[model samples]
Target: MLELQDAFARKFHYLRLSVTDVCNFRCQYCLPDGYRPDGRKSFLTLDEIRHITRAFAAMGTNKVRITGGEPSMRRDFTDIIEAVASTPGIRKVATTTNGYRMAERVADWRSAGLDAINVSLDSLDPRMFHQITGQNRFHEVMAGIDAAFTAGFEQVKVNTVLMRGLNDGELGEFLAWIKSSPIQLRFIELMQTGEMDELFERHHVRGAAIKEKLLEAGWQQRVRAHNDGPAEVFWHADYVGEIGLIMPYAQDFCASCNRLRVSALGKLHLCLFGEYGVDLRDLLQSPGQQAALQRRLREALADKKATHFLHQGHSGMTPHLASIGG
Candidate 1:
């Protein structure tokens, strides 16, 4: 069996595959001000996604995340999940969505053998949430949260981007709710990816403050044996759920970074903060090229950057978070 390892000795077992670049919401952080959908209209089909997953699985990729601008927004998303979940060497198939379409199809996705889910939720207040995401689908996202638990997903993570004076005011509310909820939460420090120079300066919240508040509130810090990704996980002594801090800028965790990202258009991105990418769609389209594609992918991993540059407008990352499935 083959395995994907980078120059820094990071064996890549996780694969984040973007299923679509189309999303319903127009979040200020993720998309550009007048972003249009005309770019990269081609999305992978269920069979195409399976082919890519199988190629990665053959190289010891056990966990595959079906991500997107909003994965559930895809018409054949459930089938895509079934395809990757059924792949031979893939042990886990998860998804990250905005939760608007998940309430209606959470059970169906779970039945298809999705191992986990992570919803991008920046606010709990309906009006505030609407303001942040540019849509009035807060109720749907809330319903989706309930549906995920009712449907029995063992790992459901809620991802919140901590921005000062924005959704950061809801940190206390999130911590309070997690005490009784059977789900995990993660606070990602505001990343200055793409063209968000002003946004980064105005609303950038330090992740350390959030962690300090949690510790002051009596949350015990314990290292878990297993982890899904880079976010440092912590548990509250009085809460039923755990919390994580993905401090990309303040606390760099790049030394242990072990993952690969494939854009919805089948481009292999080495780092989220870098502009370099290798085109794999051409390889997928050519049948009987699995061995060749595997070799090429392995070679591409050698170019993975050791760390991300977080300076506003200088990260070198060309695409926005939405396009890269953050």
Candidate 2:
């Protein structure tokens, strides 16, 4: 099988495929105003998704993370999971969600072949969670976590966007909670997009501080897997859970780039902060376009920059994270 290698020899093995761009939550950092239709209502069909997954799998991609404004918002989310998981060469099927429907649907999702799950739980405090996500479903989301474990997931990952005055002071609380739960609490640094400049300035917290605290507390950093996401995982001897730091602003953050993103609209994003995308929907119209789609993917990869210039303040065509399933 051909590998999706960039100019720097970074072989891409993971694909972040967005099943839909619509989400129900009104998260402050992402879609504070809530999701407004951009006139493009329908996303790629199930058949289109299947074709893309097969092409990527043929190119040595094994992991597919279904993201969105919130992936489970789609009615056929379980079917989507089944489609990707059944694809040959695909070893893992995961999704990142806000956990709204997780309590009721995760068991079904697990049955449909989803093995890994990541939930966005910004704050343990209900009030704080409501303040951050603009949703009062804090208790419901927590229930979803419990449901995930009951549904056979040994470890559940919780994504917490690190913000200065928001949930920054709750690290101790998070650590305490993780001490007894099999959770991987991930601290993601706040990133600046085309919009949310004010929010970004007010809340953006450096991930290095979290790393320092973890190291001082005797948490050892673990080696990354060949197809792992961009999180520096750390383990503690006394804790039942682990901590992962996703510091995108770090100088060497993109050094181990191994994933590619495809939007719900069927456009290929070489980088999260990339300026534009290569349209793959036209090729996705039929299954016979597989060879062309693979060739196009390879050709487009040659244009991928060695690293994203996000630190230079170039967000590049990305109005927000939800638009491309960040």
Total backbone clashes of model 1?
Answer: 0
| Total backbone collisions for each predicted model | 0, 0
TM-score of each: 0.95, 0.99
Q: Write candidate 1's Cα lDDT for 84-172 as tens digits.
A: 99999888888888898778899999999898999988898999888888888988898998899889976679998878887887877
Candidate 1's displacement at residue 315, Å, is 1.8
lDDT for 160 (candidate 2): 96
Number of the top-ranking candidate, with lDDT as the measure: 2
- CA deviation > 4 Å runs, candidate 1: 32-35, 222-227, 311-313
lDDT agreement of model 1 with the native: 0.83
| Per-residue lDDT of model 2, residues 34-63, tens digit only | 999878466989999999999999999999
TM-score between candidate 1 and the true structure: 0.95
